[model samples]
Target: MTTQQSAIYYPAGEIEEFLPQIGRVVEIKDHELAVFRTSDGTIFAAENRNPHPKGGPLAEGIVSGYYLYDPLYDWKIDLNTGLVQAPDQGQVQMYPVKVENGQVWVAL
Candidate 1:
């Protein structure tokens, strides 16, 4: 991992290795991140821990468009903004994601 400005970027993996619409768990420093690649090939990263009271892993959540349906409680979380959609409340900590030279990089 390397720091650029205020964020530290870590290499997650090759871009093609991340299947679209699937979430992958990546450990960067002490942070466990749930990284997702949307169907359109955009990458999004968020804390692996769920925001719900009975928290669980977000890596196994279902991805539909830009929203992630919490695996256990089914809370719809926006990947971009980390906001739990209306009818639900709370936010997931989000990280910046980017790809360079076919390698996926996540910032924390």
Candidate 2:
């Protein structure tokens, strides 16, 4: 069996470089998260912690309206709903990601 391992690192204050690709996954502090771009060119951030065995990473989690999918349980939660998905949810943390002067900046 192949196990997926995560490499935790923070991209806080480096939003420019990472903003170009919408729906891309980035790691912060060893946790996986998703970076998405709306049709209006607005960027949104969400946690990519999947609880299912065949689920994908946070970046692969579904985004609909203001909620992001859990990929495992197929649960939906608000993107701005903070790091933890819910009480006892054990979701990944969501960080504030932004781009300025062509640079991606994540609030640590």
The whole-model lDDT of each prediction reads 0.91, 0.54
C-alpha RMSD for every candidate: 1.2, 8.7
User: Which digits, one per residue and each the tens of the lDDT, describe model 2 over residues 1-108?
Assistant: 111233222343344433332467766666566776544445666665454445456666556655666555666656665343554354555666555564554544
TM-score of each: 0.93, 0.54
**After superposing candidate 2, which stretches have Cα over 4 Å from the reference?**
1-22, 28-31, 51-56, 83-91
RMSD of 2: 8.7
